[model samples]
Target: MGIKSFQGARKHQQAGEEIPLKVSDYMTTKLITFKPDQSVEEVIDSLINNKISGGPVVNDKNELVGIISEGDCIKHISDSRYYNMPMDDDRIENRMVKNVETIDGNMNIFDAANKFLNEKRRRFPIVEAGKLVGQISQKDILKATMKLKSQNWKK
Candidate 1:
């Protein structure tokens, strides 16, 4: 059992000679985006219906504007009796959130990990040249972690 050869660790080859693993590979491509004018209730329902915890928020031009989380809805729930109450037609423009954290699809997993682990972000909205594309989450990062470890084990 000299140095316990890594022969068996080749099973988790997430990347190979012909294919390279990327954030986009693991990210949720079919993103469920939100409009700033979208009601908090609507976002909450979307999160539940899609079985996702968060997503990117985009404007009418499909530009990334903000990122909304399930926790945001939970906090907003304390603001009113009916959490689903639609936004006031007149206030719709002002109701949509704008501050959101985003990342590029080509960013390495290590950088993504550092951003999420060292920063205050619960998730990252995947963006491309100012356009909302998809989203990467803590769950997605965890998956990358396992995959990276498995691949390195064979080195």
Candidate 2:
């Protein structure tokens, strides 16, 4: 599939109409998170149960440390020689990653678009003071884009 674009979606279009865009505007604050110590099995369950690819991996202090994705889990499985599946692995600590890409909660939509383009991730964990606050998916940006386009077209 071709990569999506969020070029103009990032900027707030002030065409005599309200353009909806903000972390608080679209972010799901009550979203679930993962623990770095959580088992791979648990990560699988969370992914299935929550119906999401992955989530922010938080430290003991509930701070965003890294992100876990289905792709990450799959990488471990596809590369692993272990006979045991997720059960054999506990809490995905070893599999869980650390160097996560994050964004400030107060970051403008435009900034997020830039990060998304360069970072090459589907979603970003919103962090403030090193704490995990929320997350935004590509879907959010698409919604904002459509809203802006529709609003601008109406004028």
User: Candidate 2 residues 76-150, lDDT tens each?
Assistant: 777564755545554566776678777766666766778888988889888777677789887877776666564
Misplaced by over 4 Å in model 1 are 1-8, 11-19, 81-97, 153-155
Model 1 pairs in collision: 36-96
Worst 10 residues of 1 by lDDT: 86-95
Per-residue alpha-carbon lDDT of candidate 1 for residues 4-90, written as tens digits (9 for 90 to 100):
765664544444453335678778778777777777777777889999877777778888876677776765665454655533322
| Candidate 2 segments whose C-alpha is farther than 4 A from its true place | 1-18, 82-87, 153-155
| Whole-model lDDT, model 1 | 0.69
Q: How many steric overlaps are in each model, in order?
A: 1, 6
Least accurate 10 contiguous residues by lDDT in model 2? 146-155
TM-score of each model, in listed order: 0.73, 0.75
Candidate 2 local lDDT, residue 29: 83
